[model samples]
Structure formats: structure tokens, C-alpha cells
Target: YLASEPGGRHVRLRKKGKTASLTFKVGRGAHREEREVKLSPKQFAALWPGTAGRRLRKLRYEIPWRNLMIEIDVYRGKHSGLVVAEVEFPDLATCREFKPPRWFGREVTSQNRYSNVRLANE
Candidate 1:
């Protein structure tokens, strides 16, 4: 789920297969800056409890499209039917120039209701 760190950073701890990462993001929309750090399992466990009721589970798949990559999340547990896709751009220019495939569905960028944290609570 999406959590906010101190100093107004958007934070989330992601477990991809066997690896875990702590990612910090700043700004909003297409120009956000992000940094990710590999976390030890113990470190992940220590911080995970804070998420408590906000936790969500998903299976993520990354697909290549031109120079950009598309990440699709297939949710699990109670939210099993929900699916979401995300693409991060290097800049606004790249974001504007990109075209989605016919099947990509509607854009939900910056929508609070679509965020994992919000969906988790429902």
C-alpha cells in the first residue's frame, strides 16, 4: 500500500518474489522522483506491522512496451478481481508522447480511489 514517510515522501515497501525493497517517492503526477533500497527480511518485518489494516497482496507482472515498461498488478485475497496497470515516465515529455494499447483501459493517474492503500481499506 502507499504510505507517506516523513518529509512528505510517498513510501511503500514492495516484496517482489523473494526480494524486498523500500521505495521512497517525492512530488506527484509524471515528474515524481523515486529512490528504492533493498531491505533485509528483518527490516521489512520490523516496519510491516505499522501497515496493519492497510496491507494488500498482489501479483505483479512487468511487460515491455517500446522504451517504457508497463506494470500490471493482479490483486489477491479479498480484492481478488481488481487489476491495475502502471507506467512510470522519465519526464513529462515521455508521458505525453506515450500511447496505450487498445486494451490498456482508462487512465487513473493520481486518482486516490485507485491507490492500493485506499483499496486495501475497503
Candidate 2:
């Protein structure tokens, strides 16, 4: 589940099988800062109903790459058939210096339409 708080912050309640967390995030793209709190099943259940936003479900695969990790997300449910790959860098300089593999496809990092919040609404 997802919600927007004041000042454009995002709150996300996520569950993966038996594990869950409530996350708060500010900013966007590579500049975002996130904080997560672990949640038990009971806590998740109580908070689930209060959460409001489009729900998103995806299977993420982490692959080790040259000094970085490539995260591939295969979306499910309403957003099925959409696949996206992302990589995180230590800083803006590193991010700018990086080149994508041939199989990485088009880059959409700067596209707001490709953002998770927008994708969920689609």
C-alpha cells in the first residue's frame, strides 16, 4: 500500500510472504532518502486498512554487476508485461559515469511516467 504525506513524502507498506515493512521516503530518483521500519503480521494487518493508494506487486531479481547491483523488476497484476531494470550508484558522479549493458534497453530514470507511483495508477 502507498500514501502521500505532506511535503511530497511517500509512505509505503509492503509485505513479502511473511516479512513486511513500513517505509517513508523523500525526494526522488537517485536522490531519495528512505527509512524503513520492520513490521510484524499483526502490525501490518492493523495498518493495512488505513493505507490509501494504488497497490503494486512485482518480483525483483538482484544480479551482481561490475561493482554494482542490477535490480530487475518484473511487474505483476495490472502492470504485467512491464519489465524494468535499475542500478544504484554511490554518488551522482558514479551514476553519470556508468554505462548500461546492451540488454538493458531504454533508460527511463528521468521519466516521471515510469515512476512506481505513476505506474501503480496505470
Candidate 3:
């Protein structure tokens, strides 16, 4: 799944400690649960130095499906305007494929720019 928007803003509810995370969309949509991994700034730099011509941005959308919420991401830089959606499935093949909304660009699931860890630095 994929989508593109003019833009949207969200307030992040955050907590810090081991495995830091933030929550968004409050009562609606799946909670934006994120856990920070243990990685050095040097290690993170090696992965994404903000000059790789790719950046990651994510949007958590509310879905009216079976206990599900959609996570859509828009890539920046060389991969600008690209969109992809990730929906958790009970089975690997449980997901069905369909054409994205007209606003969406292309699907780049195989692209390396979709990773959030890389996006954090880029």
C-alpha cells in the first residue's frame, strides 16, 4: 500500500530510558510505539550520514480493518515522494495487493531508504 499527501502534522508523546519510544494518534490508530536501539553515533553515521540522497519519513494512519493500523512512509532525497505502507498480518501472505491511491508514487519495498534507523540520521 502507498499514499502521498500535501502534508500532515502529528504530536509525539515520548518517554525515555532503555528502549525509548514515542506515542502518536492517541486514542485513534495503533499507538505509535517506537523503541530506540543501542547504536553508537559513529555506527549510526556510517549507516546514514544525511548525504546518501535518501531520507525516511513515516505516517501512522488509522484503518478500519481488523485490529489494524497502517504505517505509511514517504522517502526523501533521491527517493523523494516514494510511498509504502506496512500492515501487520497474522500470516505472511495474509495481505492482499492493490493499486495505490492516485496521490501515491511507486512502491519501493526492496529499497534500502525505507528503514527508519537510517532515516533518523539522514
Candidate 4:
């Protein structure tokens, strides 16, 4: 639950099934850029000791919705029963103009509590 220093980068070590990766994120909100590097389990294990952050587990489903692809996440473990859907746009204009389907519940893009990092900590 450490905060990212002002203008500093945010990094995370993630393991999904047999795949492991180290992700570096810069910027904030909807404008952030992320870069990921694949890692071996042994490498991940070595890095895990020094990494500071919560781990999250979820099942992701990608479905085509209109002109955009919607990513639905079904959380597991402590956060079970939580389902969230997200859509990425090419630009802010497209994002602002996009609309959600009936199945999509309330929008939480601006809600910090629903963010993956926050959810991991919760």
C-alpha cells in the first residue's frame, strides 16, 4: 500500500497462472503508459521478496461491445463476488463520447477505490 512518489514510476510484479511479468507504469489516471517484461518463475520469486504491493487474483473475459472491446473481470479469493467491466479508448474524446451497455453497471473509471491497485490492497 505504498504511494507512488510524485512523478515517480509505479512498478508491479504479477503472476497469472504460469506466466509472470514485471510491469512499469508511468503517468496517472487515463493517460498512463505501461510497459511489461515477461519473467521466469524463478526470477519472479527472486523479485517478489523486494517488491512492495498487494497481489490480486481475477478471471478476465474479453467481449466485443460495439466498436470497442470490453474487458470483464471476475474477482476471486478475498474479493470474490466482485465483477468489473472496463473499456479502453484511443483518445480522451472517444472515451468521453463512449456509452456503456445495459449490462454494464455504474461507471467507476474515476473511482479510486475500484482501481486494481486499490482493490488488491482491500
TM, every model: 0.84, 0.86, 0.36, 0.78
Deviating ranges (above 4 Å) for candidate 3: 1-59, 65-68, 73-84, 96-104
Q: Write one digit per residue (lDDT tens) for candidate 2, span 1-122.
A: 46774354888888887999999889877677779999999999999876544778899999999999999999998889999999988888989889999999898987887888777656
TM-score of model 3 vs. true structure = 0.36
lDDT (Cα atoms) of all candidates against the true structure: 0.79, 0.84, 0.40, 0.78
Error of 2 at 114 (Å): 1.1
The root-mean-square deviation over C-alpha atoms between each candidate and the true structure, in angstroms, is 2.5, 2.0, 12.5, 2.8
Sorting all predicted structures by TM-score, with the top scorer first, yields 2, 1, 4, 3
lDDT of 3 at 90: 50
Model 3 global lDDT (CA atoms, 0 to 1): 0.40
Best by the TM-score measure: 2
> Which segments of candidate 1 are over 4 A away from where they belong?
5-8
Candidate that beats the other on TM-score, 3 or 4, i.e. the better one = 4
- Between prediction 2 and prediction 3, which has the larger lDDT? 2
What is the per-residue lDDT of model 1 for residues 1-122, given as tens digits with 9 covering 90 to 100? 45764343677787777798888877654567889999999988888876677778888899999898999999999899989999988878888999988898888876767866567667
Residue 116 of model 4 has an lDDT of: 78
